[model samples]
Target: MSQFSRLFWIEWKKLFADKTIRKVVFLVPIIYLTLFGFLYSEEKVTNIPTVVVDADQSELSRELYRGFDADETFGLIGTVPTEEEALRWIDEGEASIALMIPAGLEQNIKAGRGAEVLTVIDGSNMMISNTAVRAANTVVKTISAGATLKKLEAQGSWGDEGMALYTGIDFRYRVLYNPTFSYLSFMVFGLAGTVLQQVLFLGIALSVAQEKEQGTWQTSVATNSFFAITASKLLPYLLAGTLNMFIGFTLLLKGFGVPYAGSTVDLMVVATAFNLAVLCVGYMISYFFKDQLQSTQIAMMIAVPSFMLSGFTWPFLSMPTAVAAIGKSLPLTYFLDGVREILTKGHGLSAVGHDLLVLAFMSVVSLFVAYLIYTFQKRKTAGTQAESTIG
Candidate 1:
């Protein structure tokens, strides 16, 4: 066989034949997908704990309380006498939402005047806050329509005319991209990508570190040119990462029912760039840390915060400037954003060109750095071989 083929086979064995590396490459990703998939399977946030502050004590006020109680998105734990008490409940973490009905609510509605219902939501957790706010708005709109219908009926306009008048301006809405607003769809793809990234980094770092620890790395560097060794070492990881990405996509579409609306070519392009960049990152880690354990530890340290820093769940600009800068330096940030645009928005490669460029840039710069490191090592290894031959 050719030298390149032999080096490829050697690297493949070094990566997959080892039990620990094999598990890190394959098993850990499966576990991460299963765990995070089930965690978000319910699809939507529901049953937010709520407190009602009803000062009116009127039948209309009670009816308003029933509106909140009937909403599946809210679970009314109890009623309180004052807004202050409800505020206390929210402050103490006893409830996520509070509904306040004022004393003149029934009087104002009967007099055909504007009545206000206050919805106070804890904004500490954005998911819960947004869910509670949406549910509250829906409930309030429904109740307001019912009240308007009753007033129109009392005025003897109880027909289609009443509905038309009540629904003035005809506010119709359409939800795009994600009609169901499923948390699973919103979260799963990014999470799976993050896991894939971490696993690939760990596997690459450990494989290189193991070679260095066993003193086999020098021999490989001594025999092959820098380009040949680099290609052979990276090829195994590139293939493995692509396979894992395929598995993740299958699980997303089949197991979790997440949609894939982009071109396969586009997906592959981004995946290839992301894989190359991540492998280079691992290569850098292996070079900096000589010990296998130290390299693995460094890999984990970088992998752990990558998702959070990737701006997947949170807005990138909303993060602290320093934090966002750190996130900008990581390849996962660009990869996840580009994948999301394709998968969720059904955008083509054109929409994600910027992200693709960033990943490509990262790959190029990192590969250059790795090449420089390899050249330095190659010179040292050649000198050692020359010295031994002379002796």
Candidate 2:
């Protein structure tokens, strides 16, 4: 017990005893969060550029233009006389969408014959296209519905029963968790997980590999029991990683107002489990490579692809079979999936049960592999009988 305590303190001392580890683990993540927080500060996109082509030259066309102007989503650029002029605005990137009212639209509507309104939307950018398309559709749908109801009233059909003949069903949708559909709230949580995984992996990987890089393990820690040294090293990082998780959660929930709908205990458990899995993997990586830079290179390389493959920004199911199989093997992929459900959908432990089990199994399997590598290396080093100048 005393030996364990001494080894633990040595591990802690070694960490603060170096400046680089302190900065990378503590300061870098905070910097990342602060910069990313601003990206989503304004939770929505507004005033999307739109244009109108009013060939009708009548009251109906003018009313349609007003509707587009009134919506916060659409910022009407200018009215043009021809389809060619409106198409030019879209091609030049001046407008995201355009509504064209045909010349005889008002005349056809007045005569109880429906008129076609052409809507041209830029499909290149999904984000802008989604908002612009919805706004345009709303304007068209509202006007058409009002005109149809009026025509029915004029023909002596009235009330909900009469309207049912024209409209089969009134489908009302309720957005439960994210009522406002703020994109910031959606993105912040996903990115928080991504950044956390990268930093923690790097921190733990560097810890083990750096000792060999600086020759400290040969002179100092090599005298210590192998299990004690490994345990002591892992404990410090586990604690630090857990604390970092809470700090990240605070920033996302308290700072950015992203919802935290799951049990606090559940969040902590998952976070700690994820940290252990990564730390175990880090140890395996540290054992495989002889140099600190080499371990970090491998880690960062894996880190780059982890986010894309994690099903956070993209759907895992939609990915190619081989690519998605690679993603499924990663710890972050499962953690991100569970985090999304717990934070956004307010799901409990049962909801994320499969992912939780997979994460725990990953941690156990990695720890076993790391332990085997550690013992095998220790045996081989003893067999080598290599003399160290520092010792």
Candidate 3:
């Protein structure tokens, strides 16, 4: 066997022998996948509570109130005589939206004048605000159209002319990809990629520390080529990362009925290249640091910034130009975009060619730097040993 191969085997064996490393490699990914997967599922956010204050005391107004209650999007939690009571419910967090119909609503509608129904919304929760606003608007439009048609019929003017005027234009809305706008479909894919990155980084960081802690790094560096040593350390992590990706995508994503329209082979290719880059980064970090605790602290610090700048949680287009430019410099940013395009948009290799090339180039560059650092550290250790022998 080659000197590097034997050294690599020794390092690999040492890594396997550590119980903490073994537990971390298995547990971290599973925990992340389970936690994020369930949190982003479609079962969340089914109904929002709302209070209604009906002062009109008219059949038409009562029908409108019933319409809001009947809709599945909202649950009519309470009926109040005064607007003050409804506001109290909102302040207490018992309701997300409050509907107030003034006393003269039916009187104005009967006189052929438009009546206003005031919708009071709590803006404290952004998701609740958006959902309440949309549901309230839909209820208002439907009720108004129905009331108008009824009034026209009572006046003996509900003819084809009235119908034509009432239905001025058909507004068709098309929701692409996820027609139902299921949150699970959108979030699961993102969570899967994120979990993969975290596990891969943590695994590599710990792997390097194992060598340092066991005092094997000095011996391995003296006997093996830096490239060979780095590769040997990286190989197991690459396997672990790839396996984690497959398990997350299959169990969490596909099992939840999220679409997997992308080319599997292409995703694997990109993921493999990305994992190698991450492994090299881990080795480079190890060369600079000596212990597992320091490595973990540095890894976590690096991960938080890398994840934030990756454009997964936040859109790159919405950020300031300078901030966006800096985010684009991160490798995770490109990898995330490529993963999203391939998995969500079903984009081909040609579309993600630029990102793939960038990842490949980064991997090569990082590996070379790690090799050089390892070589330097090795020479330093050897010179110290020679001096000690002379003494």
TM-score of model number 1: 0.58
Model 2, residue 346: C-alpha shift (Å):
1.5
C-alpha lDDT values of all predictions:
0.76, 0.70, 0.70
Q: Clashing residue pairs in candidate 2, if any?
A: none
Q: Best-fitting candidate, measured by lDDT?
A: 1
Off by over 4 Å in 3: 1-171
RMSD value for candidate 1: 13.9
- Per-residue CA lDDT of model 2 for 1-391, tens digit only, reads 6999999999999888776666666866775464335433444445667778888888767777887788777778788878899877765557767777878887887775656777776543345555555667787767667666766778887777564744211212222345455777666766777788888778878887888888776443435665687688778998988899999898778887776677767777788888888777777777778778777866775675676667565443235556668778888887876776677656677767888899889878877787787667666665555553335
How many backbone collisions does model 1 have?
0
lDDT of 3: 0.70
lDDT of 3 by residue, 3-107 (tens): 999999998887789765755677556755653444344333335687888898898678877888787767788789998898777655467678888788877
- Greater-TM-score candidate between 1 and 2: 1
* Candidate closest to the true structure, highest TM-score: 1
Tell me each candidate's RMSD, in Å, in order. Answer: 13.9, 15.5, 15.4
Which candidate order results from sorting by TM-score in descending order?
Answer: 1, 3, 2
lDDT of 1 at 229: 76
Candidate 1: residue 198 Cα off by (Å): 1.2
Clash pairs of candidate 3?
none
